[model samples]
Target: MVAEDDEINRMLTHHQLLDTGLVLEFAENGKVAVEKARANRYQLIMMDIQMPEMDGIYATKAIRLLPGYAEIPIIAMTANVFSQDRQVCLDAGINDHLPKPVRTEYLYDTLLKWLEK
Candidate 1:
């Protein structure tokens, strides 16, 4: 699953993830991401931090409160690459952080790290 507000970024991510053989779902903002996440089962969630309606940190926290989602890996995807930003994600219950524009190798490796167990 991916939560991203930018259409171009979402499309790019979709193309990059096509080879992973995972069924991808998308949300335009954090609010929709939370709703979709609650309604479906996803192996991993790639979340954009700057989305409107709700930010990724808040969305991750909200998702963490949902039944069966506490252990799910929610990785923050954002242009914010500073250590402080990464710590913020971790504090918000995100399992990992990925800097954008997302590199295919990193994205693939991150997904494998969380989903291939």
Candidate 2:
């Protein structure tokens, strides 16, 4: 599942990830992301950090408290490139961080790293 507020970024990620042959679902904001995550089982979640209504950090924390979600890999996708921002994602229980605009190769590699395991 991908939780992103921007349509263009979401579409781009969708296209980039299609080649992996994994079924994908999208959420337009962090609030929706948390709801979908709680109601469904996903192998991985691509979370946008700076979203409206909740933000990825809060969403991730909320999801972490849900049943069977503790082990799920939640990767943070954000424009904030600071070391402190990455640390915040880690503190929020995000498994990894991917900075935007996410490059196709890097995105693929990141997904592969989590999904393949």
Candidate 3:
């Protein structure tokens, strides 16, 4: 699952994951992401920090409270790469941080790190 406000970022990820046979589900805002999460189980989630209705941090925290989602990996995909920003993401219950524009290698690596287990 992916929670992102930007169409380009969502499409880039869609293209990148096409070959992996992963079915992509998109949420344009944090509210939608939480709604979708309520209905399904995802192997992993890619979340954008900035979004409408609710921000990624809040959405992540909300998702963390859902049953069976506590151990799922939720990765932050954001332009903010500062140490403090990353710490904040971690503090919000995000499993990992991927700085944008996300390189193909790093994205795949992060997916593997969480999904391969």
Candidate 4:
């Protein structure tokens, strides 16, 4: 899966999973993320909310509309934890939301939990 923007967060997330042997791709913005996700088969997608050209919420919707990505899980990673933000992500068709500065344990748990569904 591709991580969109927030270099430090991406690095920490990637590093934390290095031992797991998961190949991660990075994109600087939602546009690139959308492109990459469509270019390959991703088990999941983790991305920041704020990005140039396109935002995570919008990208998530676009991805959902894509031919083969309707059921693919796209988890929103945002600093905003407001109920409205959560609702917005949900309304946009995102399966789940994770706050920024994501902890390794939570990431692993969320992925496992969602993948099991």
lDDT to native, each model: 0.92, 0.93, 0.95, 0.81
lDDT score at residue 55, model 1, on the 0-100 scale: 91
Please give the TM-score that candidate 2 achieves against the real structure. Answer: 0.97
Task: Report the C-alpha lDDT of model 2 over 11-35, residue by residue, as the tens digit.
Answer: 9998897877889999999999989
Clashes in model 3: which pairs? none
By summed lDDT, the worst window of 10 consecutive residues in model 2 runs over 13-22
Q: TM-score of predicted model 4?
A: 0.92
Cα RMSD to native, each candidate?
0.7, 0.7, 0.7, 1.3
Which tens-of-lDDT digit does each residue in 1-117 have in candidate 4?
A: 755677787778778788876778887888888888778878778867888799988888877877788888888888988999999989988888888777788888888887777
Clashes in predicted model 4? 0
TM-scores of the models, in the order given? 0.97, 0.97, 0.97, 0.92
- Badly placed stretches (over 4 Å) of model 3 are none
Ranking by lDDT: 3, 2, 1, 4
User: Could you tell me the lDDT of residue 54 within candidate 3?
Assistant: 93
Colliding pairs, model 2: none
